[model samples]
Target: MAVSQTADTEELMTCLRIQLYHPEPQNIFSSLPMDNRLKQEAEDPVRLGRAAEACPFVLNDTKVSRKQLALMAFRVPGSTEMRFHVQNLSRKGRLQVNGIELRHLVGAELPDKALIRFGRYEMLVLREPGDSETHFEVLFERRIVAPSQEMGEGEARTVPVMESEDVTLSWREPINEPSESDEYQNC
Candidate 1:
């Protein structure tokens, strides 16, 4: 009887983790900050926004609303597979998942791997299997674009250009003689 109860408890367990992901740091000595990572249970919904009292995962950006979005976990009917869904709660901020936009109060099923964008933030969501629990990782990234520099009078101005790594050129030989079909058409 106790074994069956334990199995039931384990089957209901779900774990979720969120971390700030940096694709490539300009400095090699820089390391990932521990304060940016968070862990929570999937049974309860996770709220993200600028308010610390209402949301456990708080974003300090002013552009984020009080409750920007919520992540909810659900189990597939007739199957043990677990999946996650995201809902946009903010009326001012737009939510995007895998390039698909969600309006206010709109929700959508999250893919196994997805790129989510809200305001100036981007998150990579990944679903992975765990021992005795369903595990999910949300890698968060803040998109920051560098501003153009202004030059004073009599100073030279230069713009930065990015070079492409994949550049291909194809060359074909031209035919001097006309084909039989061209001769027939002419006649």
Candidate 2:
């Protein structure tokens, strides 16, 4: 249908058309107008470069040290037991985080008290599990955006490994219980 070449077409209708139900999650990471834009190819098709902060990293309490934490961003007072895949670029080791990981915070409904935190000349997440968003001083250091592909060098392997309801934090394989081989031990 050759639509009208009229002077006016409703902007809301145009927006709805663009908002078709794509299987992929919506990009909630909107940046300021002045913020420059760049493109990167990561596990997700294409992403904003300069606006890396907009990628939507969330954190919970105790999952990180109170000291300098870089390459992390955002915090939330939350619940709903969740797991997150965080990009850690620090000295490798197991670390305790008291709340849900930030990776899973994507597309999450944020609380009124939730505030984003960035630290260590980069960015990290801060979380408070009980949704207690009182006047907590959410301090963090701003950092330059690191390319998603450029992983920092570390001797230890760090990734999300979840067991039990309480998420135990670790930088390397725990020396105590081996992750496997206990299968047949019960026999």
Candidate 3:
């Protein structure tokens, strides 16, 4: 009976592979590399922040708060499939998953493939069906389209660009100019 229970526990284990990228490599700080890989098991929630002692995956940036966020793994009732959720922990630095923004203490279910951005750093999170074995892979960079190619030839127009690799302009609505009160919200 004990053996059967251990097997069941092992079967519920899942792995997450996070590949970090810096869009502006030249401007990146010396502490942050251009591309990095981090792998973790879904057993415990993983914390991410600027503090090395508190977070296993340390993001060394001034814009990043001491406690930025956490990723937790869970399984739905009556299902063996593992799922992940992200919680924003920083009161100042907002977290962006895909194209949606999450404020402090807010959490959302993470997709199998998600583009996460915080503190000028971007990471691609991929869910894998397995134990805590480590894996690494390179992520594709966002393609830059010239303004002239996307807009009408004669008319001068400005387009809002989302830095995430998975997001496209087609579905995104144009953002209005920020008000005076909204300007300092992120600060």
CA RMSD, predictions in order: 15.2, 17.4, 10.9
Candidates in order have lDDT scores of 0.54, 0.26, 0.58
Compose the digit string of candidate 2's lDDT tens values, residues 43-162: 221111222443222222233322212222233247432222233232332222223233311222222222222231122333323222221212222223431112332311242222
**What C-alpha root-mean-square deviation, in Å, does candidate 1 show against the real structure?**
15.2
Deviating ranges (above 4 Å) for candidate 1: 1-39, 131-187
Using lDDT as the measure, name the better of candidate 2 and candidate 3. 3
Q: CA shift at 4, candidate 2, in angstroms?
A: 49
- List the candidates ranked by lDDT, beginning with the highest: 3, 1, 2
Which regions of candidate 2 are displaced past 4 Å?
A: 1-48, 51-79, 88-120, 130-187
lDDT tens string, model 3, 71-129? 88767688667767888889998877665677788877776766676865666676665
Whole-structure CA lDDT of model 2: 0.26
Steric clash count of candidate 3: 0
lDDT of 1 at 157: 18
**TM match of model 3 to true structure:** 0.57
- Please count the clashing residue pairs in each candidate, in the order shown: 0, 17, 0
Name the Cα RMSD for model 3.
10.9
